[model samples]
Target: MKLVVEVKLLPTPLQAEALEATLCACNTAASWVSGVAFDRRTYRNFSLREHTYAEVKTRWGLGAQAAQHVIKKTCDAYATLRANLTAGRLGGPGSKRHRLASGKPIEFRAAAAQPYDDRMLSWQLDARTVSIWTTRGRLKGLAYTGGREQLATLARYRRGESDLVHRDGAWFLLATCEVPEAQPNSKPVDFLGVDLGVVNIATTSDGHVMAGRRLNRSRARDHELRAKLQRKGTKSARRRAQRRRRKEARRTRDINHKIAKHIVAEAERTGRGIGLENLTGIRERVRLRKPQRAMVHGWAFAQLGVFIAYKARRAGVPVVYVDPAYTSCTCSRCGYVDKANRVSQARFVCRSCGFVDHADRNGSRNVRARAQAFWRSGAPSTAPAALTGLDADGTPQPAVCRNASASRQ
Candidate 1:
């Protein structure tokens, strides 16, 4: 599979300045293009895609490549905003009309110059040194294998992934790679169910819970600090608040990454497929106060899921997303549905069957059942089973059962 490898570019001071200047020029060009589009949409009957790299270069007095870079950056931003609007993820048209009319500057992030040649973007290496160059400047860094290894390590991207830009400071590169299509030769063996919740980030069908302890604590502290900072209303306090906000975000992301990695690794160790809840529209369903809302606004559950999916694919495992419908409320044993079934935050007692189990475990059992159903229907059943459970001291638990189903084989 194709992958992207990103190495930090180390340029000389002069080169850095030149690169910065090029980025500034590109930003200016993008602003101008946005202004043109705005004016046309405001007054004219039609808007045109008449802004070309060559034309921008000539009009803006920037070098040919640099001007083109700027225009591309601007177009990228427009595309991002457009996408958000189309996806109903951002404000609609005229929502930012006041800002536009006030001549407030439209901001754009720095753009990297594209490689001029198409031959896998040539790189030279000597000893421990590596370097590549674009029209703007040379990118000097460590060299990695030019193929999958390099791509995967540097870019964390696979082959065929598309590139998309966002308003955030981070850059995204997506790649899709091909693997031999999965062909199950035996009946289905076992299924591991996954349930994601606010308290416990994930509960597995095997009765294991990856609790969201760090996230909860981090969020709580962040809220407390934010309150104190707002009360102070000092410049230093505001700066400290921003620092704390960033730290909390980083901590949350780190925790999520670790949890996802552990989950995928465990699943790969077993020879069973994974079943997960399809949590679409979950964010909208969860109601919270403003402070809590802000803390959870970008929790990245989707990103975490994506990470798990891709990792599973690489390990030749399958991930199935089942409808979440009543996984939480329905009793896994008797399929009873009642609000009173969940007596507390951590307990699930079925009224019909009198089945008692950890709430997360019950959800996971339902997830596994759903996954097994999908597998029996001749759907793609590729994810491996998780490693066995844990001992009383939390050590690795041995596999207790292994039975291939009629469909899995």
Candidate 2:
């Protein structure tokens, strides 16, 4: 499977300035190329390069490979826009959002990430350094650092292009690694069912519940802080809000990672597959009050699902996605489906058989039963059980293999 491992780059002040200048120039040139492509209706790489290649090199003072990369990146941006339009992500045809998106040429941020091929970038894993091309010159011996596992992965399985990303005043290189998957456990004792929710982050069929009370409280505080900062409307306040938002994102991601790691590890240890819900269009399917909407929308159930899928894939554990309709309201014991079964957010009592269980736990058990049925019903053997279908949000994000401190120096 293809995974991306991020490593931090520690550059000298002068090197950092050069890197920043190079990125700005590349993005500026890409924006110009996008304008030309939009005006001329030419989005293909070769054809668009024919029109902008020489000019990009001369105008931006970029080398041959960099110029080519700039043009290709612009083309890719347009291609992505087209895909989004086709998928109605922007809006339906002639809608205001659709018109706004289609009416203008794409623009690249000055600090946008740039892709580097092997010809432009080289890694020195043994010395924990890198040699990369910059507008100033070929910068060599630029120190970089990563977690031990990430460094080992880079040394052993790193492949393809790496992206130079500038985020929050930090530089990182996202290196692609082609890690080999372990032999899958086709026959498992059972499936570990995980029910994802806003109140409880995850409830496994094994009766394990990872509550989200603390996380929710933290988010509420962060949200309140952001609102106050916005109301204050000062530059420093805006900056602090941005930093807090980023910190909150990191915290959420960390929590999801730990939860996913534990779930995958337990499933693998017990010889069980992982079962998840097919939560596509969940945001649209769910209806809640104004106050509850924020909590539900912020639920990162999709991210948690993706994390589980990727980790399960690496551990050679199969994952099955089952329909989630009425999983909460249905009685796991008597197989009776009724909305009245769920008496509250946390309690479930079966009206048919007088069986009582935690609502989320009962939902997880139902999910486990459905997954078992799906697996035994002669599902396709050629398909990869883990992450075979689209992710919860109807998009398959790049599988990121990250550690606790993958980019820490």
Candidate 3:
């Protein structure tokens, strides 16, 4: 229910520098703490325990609230690393795991000081701002301490909203606030089935399809630029390549976010739960060429699902992930399964009952069916599907349909 709102901070040049320094210090302290935990776990039979706000304040010379903020951020990073390691998603110890840059030394940034009240923390807006505060100088920018107006704005946060993050480059005040839950007086009767695919993005059980737009044009453009840069082998070209990489990443993320938001909105409007494919082990099961593998990996399927779930939760709707087995091959009409059921990448023609449907549509139907089954069994909202399409060997059955479909009408 908590939502984070980020607003730009206006501070002088000196303040910015000071803020950056403070952040660096905090990051360094956090890294040292994490290293200590890692060492303890390695040499001593001890588990990691996150340092509390008070502990950090006392040890690191930070204010109580400021220490808490740094601790939270550090714990979040640690959790990311831990998950990656457990999932085998991280490359070996020397490789980049999640966001931690491998081989780069961990450093801290600006420091945070907790306010007298538990609600806020104070940090230098910038180096210039820091200088001003230290020397009692003045600057031309809006000056307002954390107060009632800020608190009011913080209360508007809704689920699925982007978090307000404070970066070293800029100063901002951000807080995660909660939105009221909506209550529909009437009971819900309808449901929407959503199937996520590599090629098509999403297909609803109701026959609504959101085709994946080929970002290949953008990819191709980037490739040409990269190749030219590689041939030039100049420092400027390398810099340009880095900028291009960042831009492309931003564009791709924007597209995915838009698609996810649209899908969630549609489901919410219909007052129905969204049924989706449980894609837990999808990446491991599919075989692809090198280029294709990279593309698929970069699709951020997990983020899309997460967006749908959080958005649905906020809207008082539900999201259900069903087993992804046989979603593509099983006939939505008669539940017939066969390898030959899929006529092509985009088409599904059931061999057993001659049922013809879109490949994604069939998958969506299967997803809905699985959701209904779960609901009937009184499974928890967070429970995974009971029966996946994979057999004993972890190979998916060709024609075994897994997801259920709602009538398009």
Candidate 4:
């Protein structure tokens, strides 16, 4: 896995200004290259190299390595633009025609940052300081701090390039580290169904729920604070409110990380893969009441999914996405599907089968069933005893992964 760890830079005023100047030169070089590529209708390397290598050094006064990196950055952008234009012209699904494909010159916004490749960037003396080739000269003694664990991991698995970014009155080194893929030895026998919702962040088919009461309260508080700040009509209040909102987002992300860790640990303990709904494009397809829509939009289900996926990958666990249509209403016991089956927000009463259960749990069960069927059809089952079929009580027939979530203390 490739991950980027951001480290705070502690640079002297002179060093900061020099680095900023270097970044400006590189961006100027890149902007020129982008315009040339579009004007000539070619992003070929040798052509760009011939045009930029000497010109950037003399005109932009950039270092040799910095000029090369600039050419690489702009050429990559042009390559992507050309590929996207081709795909759009071919009518590929979800690929819209780019405005630049109409022959308008591509614009590269001026910025005080540059992407440093391995050839131009390296640690100076130790992890504290880093050295980079700048336009003026090689600047050293640029120190960075924090991210102790990330630094350790980078030392263990450093393999990729990093981008130096200047944002919010700070210079940050966004370093990337690659992790080796774990061997696929999980041998999952079944799946643990997880239904994501607003009230409850996650509901497992095993009848356990991770409630989102605290998250909802935090959102409400944030909204109230925002409204009050707006009413204050002061510039400082507005700024404070913005900072508070960012803090709330960070807090919510921390909680989501914990929840995902717990959920993946449960799946690993049960020797099961996780089943979830394929909620792609759900926002555009589903319309809800004003309050419900806000809750839905405010929720971080997508972030939770990403967290689960990465954690599960490292743990050698499998994840499956199933269709979401009618999952809440479908009867887990008798396979009966009707919108009326979901009698309330939290309750599910199957009219045809007279079965009762929590709505989210029912949805989870349906998701698991679909995923099981999908896997069985796609891949030969190694263990027939772990078929993930629902029993008469609407629980998993396979006992190996049964009650995995509910068993937690």
Candidate 5:
């Protein structure tokens, strides 16, 4: 399993400047290569490599590794763009469908950090410092600070490439490390279901809730503050707003990490697989009012899912993503499905079975049921039936038992 650990770095101003300069040079080189690739519709490394090294090193004062990394990144970007285009993922106005990009090379707006491979970087555990290459040459004694556990973890594994980032006013090293997988579980009894939402963040079938009201409130405050600062139209206000946004993002990320850790640990301790909603493209699927859309779209449901999955994998807890259809409206007690079953955002009253429970909790139970059905079928997960299906004339069909088709996986 691969994980990234952010280690605070202590670097001289000159060293920081050098790193930033190298990143800028990398971005410049990539832009040139990407422009060429886009024009020729060539993304292979060999084709892209033909433009590298000699001219790049002279043009950007980049070392051998830095130049190669830039060319590689440009090729990768074009490859990704091609793949997405092939999948029909990229389209609409202003998107490149046929014509090449403008003559001006589309440069990376942000400084593209130079990646270090084993050939260009080394870490010393005793000194807590890393030797990384820069445009000027190799820069040694770049100190890193992190918890003892993090330091030990980094020392244990073969460290992958680490990106040097300049955020706000601090210089930090984002270190990637590979850790061994946990022992396999002999038997798993049941599954723990997690329902994610903007209100509570996560609600598990075991009756545990990680409330998100406070987080939501904080996010609202950030939004208000940003709008207010922007209206002021002052340089200082802009800078202050930027700092606040960064702080809010860091705080929210920390909370998510904690929540993911707790949920995964619970599943591991109880020897149960985890059931999570398969919410891919949920934002596009669900319609919301303007006010509600902002809140729902701002929440990081996908990031939380990723965090939960990776942590569960490291803890030997199997995870299953169930069809999210009818998970919220279906009654876990009687398997009744109806939009009216959800009386409110937080309350659920089943007209079919008279079952009453928290809406998210009910959804979590339904998620668990679907996961169990999927496990029994022993096949890839598929989307659950829609909560309210449409008839031949496009009228909403009354909710009824639709698990028969679902059972076939």
Candidate 6:
């Protein structure tokens, strides 16, 4: 699997100035190339390069590699826009959002990240420094820092292009690394069902609930601060808002990483597969009040799911996506389904059998049941086996269920 390892650069003042200039020059040239491409209706990298290559090099003072990267970046931006239009991410063709996106030529921000090939960037792990190409010259001995694990991963598996990013007055490099995956576990006792929710970030069929109240409160505070800053309508206020936004995002990402790591570790330790709810198109399918919408929209459910999947893959743990419809309201103990079964956000009462349990826990149990059935009945998940950590022949099953309430742990 390919992962990105980010390292913060500690560049000298002069080096920072050079990098800033380089980024500005590259993006400026890319914007010009985009306009040219729009005029000629040419978007292919090589074809577009034919029209802008020489000019980009001369005008931006870019070397051969930098010039090529600039043109390629411009082409990529247009390609992404085309993909968004095709995917209906911008809405219907007749919608104003879609029309506005399709009508204008793509533009690149002055501070947009620039990709650096190996020729343009070199890393020294022992010295903790990087030598990189810049508009001023090839700048060397730019110190960098990262977590120990990230640094180790970068040294061992780093490959391909690294993106040079300038954000919030700091310089960083996002290096791609190709990490090897563990052998897939074909045999499993049972599946660990994970139910994702707004109130509870994740509830395992094992009856573990990761409540989101504290995180939600922190996010609410951040949102309020941003709104207040925006209302000020000043440059400094906007800058502060941007920094706060980044801080909130980092906090969420760190929490998700920890949660995913713990879940994967537990599954690996107990030799069980993971079952996750399929919550695709949830935002479009669900309706909420204005206040609820902000919380829902800000929730990073998909990111959490992705983290679980990749971490699971690395641990040789199989993951399955179960149908989420009615899982929340269905009775896990008696197989009864009713809207009223969910007495409140946190409680579930099955009317048929008079069973009671935590709502999210019950939902997770349903997820586990569906996953077990799907595995036995040979129902393929929407995601490919490579991504979900399953195999073509499926994992070998035990003779019988050993732990009936295994998810509780």
TM-score of each candidate structure, all chains considered together: 0.71, 0.93, 0.69, 0.77, 0.85, 0.92
- The lDDT of each candidate is 0.57, 0.86, 0.56, 0.72, 0.74, 0.83
Candidate 4 lDDT by residue in tens digits, 38-69: 78876887788887789888998876777877
Identify the leading candidate in terms of lDDT.
2
RMSD of each: 10.5, 3.4, 9.8, 9.4, 9.4, 7.3
- Of 2 and 3, which scores higher on lDDT? 2
Question: Which pairs of residues collide in candidate 2?
Answer: none
Worst 10 residues of 1 by lDDT: 400-409
For candidate 4, report its TM-score.
0.77
Q: What is the descending lDDT order? A: 2, 6, 5, 4, 1, 3
Best by TM-score: 2
- Who is ahead in TM-score, 5 or 6? 6
Candidate 2 lDDT by residue in tens digits, 120-153: 9999888999999999999999999988888888
- What count of clashes does model 5 give? 0
Q: For candidate 5, lDDT tens digit of each residue in 1-409?
A: 6566667788888888877877777787788777877677667887767856578888878777778877877766665456555655556435665334332344664554456677777888798888888887788998889877677777786455766666666766666666666875535788899998889999999989999999999999999999899999899999999999878877777787788899999999999988888787787788999888778878877657666766776788877887789888999999989999999999999999899999999999998888888777787542222311223342322111111100000
* Worst lDDT 10-window in candidate 2: 400-409
Error of 4 at 143 (Å): 2.2
- Tens digits of per-residue lDDT, candidate 6, 225-263, equal 999999998999999999999899878877777778888
Query: Could you tell me the TM-score of candidate 6?
Result: 0.92
Error of 2 at 114 (Å): 0.5
Query: Which stretches of model 1 miss by more than 4 angstroms?
Result: 1-6, 41-52, 58-66, 92-106, 109-122, 125-188, 227-243, 289-298, 378-409
lDDT of 5 at 290: 89
Clashes of each: 32, 0, 39, 1, 0, 4
Total clashing pairs in model 6: 4
| Segments in model 2 whose C-alpha atoms lie over 4 Å from true places | 381-409
Clashing pairs in 6: 186-395, 186-396, 206-407, 206-408
The lDDT of model 2 is 0.86
Model 4: pairs clashing at backbone N, Cα or C within 3 Å:
1-179
